[model samples]
Target: MPQAVICAYARTPFGKHRGALSGYSATELGAMAVKELLERAGIDPASGVIDQVYMGHVLQTGSGQAPARQAAMNAGLPVTTPCTSVNKVCGSSLKAAMIAATEIRAGVSRMVIAGGMESMSNAPHFVRRARRGEEVSYAALESVLVHDGLKDAYTGEAMGNAGETIAGEHSISREQSDAFAIRSHALANKAWDEGWLDKESFPVGGLERDEGIRPDSSMDSLSGLRTVFSDGGQITAGNSSQVSDGASAVLVASEEAAEEHGLPVLARIIDYATSGVESHRVMSAPIPTVRNLLKRNGMSMDDIDILEHNEAFAAASCAIQMVLGVSEDRPSDIPIPFRNPCTVLVRVRLAISGAPDQLSR
Candidate 1:
């Protein structure tokens, strides 16, 4: 029997600050959402309804004493509920949800909670060895580049300067990059206006609203912004999502379990697939990922009714859509894509703030 989606919820207004949400640890954020989800569904957190918790975190600021278990403990769930954390780059949380669903479907678990949390604001900045030790500094003082230290893994020249290389290699034009940034704010604003986001959003203590939304933006206003990657590079701060503090979680259960609990489900996770692309070209994964997923399910692009492509980089997104043959026409300021031969749909809704470098970082 197929597993059922008991319920799904995501908290953490995607933004760049830790202000009101500051004090809470990553485990705390996950726990808060997990608890809220159970309470809203009128389920007891400590009940056996949840058999496990799967969380996703990119940067661990040493908050969790066993992050997954910490989240479950914080949520007041049963101590016996096994928990774990998963990291799949940007796909962290989404993959976590899929894994929980798989467990329920396989009869290994009756119910599970899965999601991801990233608090980039709380992500600590590390000081290099030379900064921490005078001996290392003195040894390096004798020669330039003599520390024999590993450089930024991405660029081999420092992470910040690597954006220029990517921009040049990708041929991302200045105007095109800015236009993408503008579209993100506009589409995100539109999503809020349409109430499309209300379905998944759970209000956290600090964020009743997503801080990423920018209304006072215009192409002209963005034109004068300075580039951070290089002298003539296109990337800028306004074109990316902020270093945010938030978490999202969803519940899954076996079909029998959901029926017994009388839980309402959202969408079914029919299948999930991922791939390894050139790490620098990480954005390329969605293309192959979706292709593999559809292939495994015996489905095609035409079968999807909606898509939520994480707008990591505008150029990458544009490339993926073009590769998939997705075309959109914006009229009356409404953007709709050609979903299939028979119908038109919106392929992606953009949301951004900082430079394209933000994606790689």
Candidate 2:
């Protein structure tokens, strides 16, 4: 079996909700990242070397038909290239890459473009039952972002509320969560200032930097914010993931293809696994998932050098750390502002640094 490796990757700087990147649709953002990936990999647009395109996208209600196809066409990939849009919610883009790697490893594809994109700023609103031809006094408008992207379909509970439950179960305190949020922002700002984030990102919509980082974030400030999920919940807006827009793309190729094209192999895809837990314990899913991944790979937490668990809420990260026996002081190199899109960017950083690290989210 051929090994799959990442040859190149690029991402647009995450834009705050309704901020710099609001003008572009999700497909447009995806196209920009794909274009940047091709340029960085030194692949000519006309080469037709790209065998497939797989892009993850949520909030696709009004984005149109075949968003991945639109992104590929917009990025100048030959129309002959096949495109797939994945929708595993928060894991969409990461799962896209995983699918691309599986295809490459199985010898079905030689080269592929895989990543994720989202435009929360432009996610559409829906008038529930408006098209039913029923006489109603009012039509309720629902946020597609919340209804589709940020809510648990099975339980109808908001994701933040789920995070709150996880935090409560795990005994994660407000102070601890606040501290983690503060550290995340501080590290993100530092990464930007040190030029680490610049290597993997390209300017988009006149925005060259991530707009969500708060340089003045402090425990005092975070503590004062009221909780949005529950009456007295510890999960506050200051410590939760931001509503942001961004895109990321990576070129995945078989080792033989990389050698033939002279493309640099960033990192090899050793293996991947997925697991599930109770619906309401969504935030705790990573705990068992990571454990299964490590067990299957015959590795332990001690053997892993870097971990990039999603910080959807500070409580999620705190819960993972506590259960996995990871130290609270462990430093994360990348600032994960958006969910699926930023995963590819983190992989880019890992490859560029030439570290023998394993990433889990």
Please list the C-alpha lDDT of all candidates, in the order they appear: 0.58, 0.82
Q: How well does each candidate superpose onto the true structure, as a TM-score?
A: 0.79, 0.94
Candidate 1 similarity to native, TM-score: 0.79
Tens-digit lDDT string for candidate 1 (1-361): 6655645454555544555566666677777777876786778886667888888765664564677678778888988888898765455666777788788878888888887765554555433566665455333442111111112345444232433444455565667656766776777677677775665566677566566566666778778888765677665666544445667677777777777888755445566677876555555567788888888888977765444555434455455556766554421122211011010011112111111113335
**Would you give me the overall lDDT of model 1?**
0.58
Model 1, total clashes? 6
Model 2 regions lying over 4 Å from their true place: 136-139, 329-331, 334-349, 352-361
